[model samples]
Target: RARPGLRVDAMVLSGGGGEREQEEHAALTAFCPGAELRLTVLKLADGRLPAQWEEAKAAVEDLRARTEPDLVLAPRTDDAHQDHRGLAKLMTTAFRDHLVLGYEIAKWDGDLGRPAAYQPLPAHIAEEKVRLLQEHYPSQRHRPWYDREAFLGLARIRGIECHARYAEAFAVTKLTLDLGD
Candidate 1:
């Protein structure tokens, strides 16, 4: 709604083409009805992305060959999850010209860190986000941190930083500003 004609192309690199992947597709569809979503699972074993580095790199390289995204949302390089860290490293190399924002995933590893950028969300949108997370991803319901409180708490803290009711934060390793003369 913010950008009426915003074009979104999402690539799921580590998905295993299982129930979880299906749920992810459904969630994305529910969240952004018109966005284009591409799922190209490398079929690598979960949590073993580092071990399959070559394959992962190849898959990302293929994605870069096909599309040139204006902005890329990737995992943080310092993320504790091997898969996220591997992909984060690749994003820097693959989309060197694009503005790549590293997104943090709340996990048991407790790797959340200070972010350099934030996008404020309205109360209705924030509440809807929590609802979608719970409703679409039934597979994640078992995790203790996968509840409403955890999601809302983080959003509230981020919102306080940006003076909004709710917000999402991103870690930016590099930025090039153009101050037109």
Candidate 2:
């Protein structure tokens, strides 16, 4: 359950490809049949993203040409992984008009770029979220928690800046606000 003031309308999966993506999409849909989640599997060949940067860009451009959303969430360019950086730039170029936010998965060195928005979770929620990640992403069972928790912990710590107990971080590309004043 979310906080009293929090609300989630829909979930969209972007830039996931390969067996892991397919399996995760199926499981997500099954777990939340009524959630109306749209999982779009980008054509990039998984770990081969850096080698096919232009292709990924074209795929995102196609996504932009076909659909539009008020906001877009993508991988943070701060990542050490070239794939993450490519996807981040691709999303930024494709959804130029929407709020494109980046989500980080902590990597070596100083997580590349900095993020601006943080979405906090309760300690309990954070633990549960990590559990879910471990359970669903068995392919990552071998990797150390630093790759995962470091990311979430950053969110939690960043959230603390905004008075949240725990949270997720995002980098926005564009944002529009209505001035009621």
Candidate 3:
């Protein structure tokens, strides 16, 4: 809604096949209506991405072949999850010319850190995001950290950091600023 002509494309490198993949696809659709989503289930064992490094890198290379994204949103390099960390490490290697923003996934591992960038979210948008998460991903509802409060609380903290009511944070390992010379 913010950017009228913006084209959004999401690529999921690690996924379980069948029903779980379908559920994730549906959730992504609900979260970003009209966005293009591609799921490549490498079928790597959970928390073992480091062991399946070749396959992970291959999947990312394939995505790079298909899309030349201007900006890429990927898991933070320092994320606790092995799958997330593996994918994050590959993002810059594959999308060398694009700006890749490493996003955080709040989870039980407590890997949240001081992010270098922030995207301010209005109250309405923040609330809607939490509602969508609750409504679309039923499987995750059981997790203690999957409730509205957890989401909103993190948003609130990030908001304070960025001087906004609510916000999303990202870790940027490198950035090039273009101030017209």
lDDT of 3 at 57: 86
1-181 in candidate 1: lDDT tens per residue? 5555566666666566688678777887788766666656557787888788898899889888988888999998888888898899998899988899999788887789999999999988899999999999898899978999999999999999999989999998888999999
Q: What order do candidates take by TM-score, descending?
A: 1, 3, 2
**Better candidate by lDDT, 1 or 2:** 1
lDDT of each: 0.85, 0.65, 0.83
Candidate 3 lDDT over 23-54, as tens digits, reads 77787777767555665555666678788899
User: What C-alpha RMSD separates each model from the true structure?
Assistant: 1.5, 4.3, 1.7
Q: Which of the two, 1 or 2, has more TM-score?
A: 1
**TM-scores for candidates 1 onward, in order:** 0.93, 0.75, 0.91
Best candidate (score: TM-score): 1
Question: Cα lDDT of model 1 overall?
Answer: 0.85
Q: After superposing candidate 2, which stretches have Cα over 4 Å from the reference? A: 1-18, 30-33, 110-113, 146-152
Candidate 2 backbone overlaps, count: 8
Which window of 10 residues has the lowest lDDT sum in candidate 3? 1-10
Model 3 CA lDDT for position 121 = 97
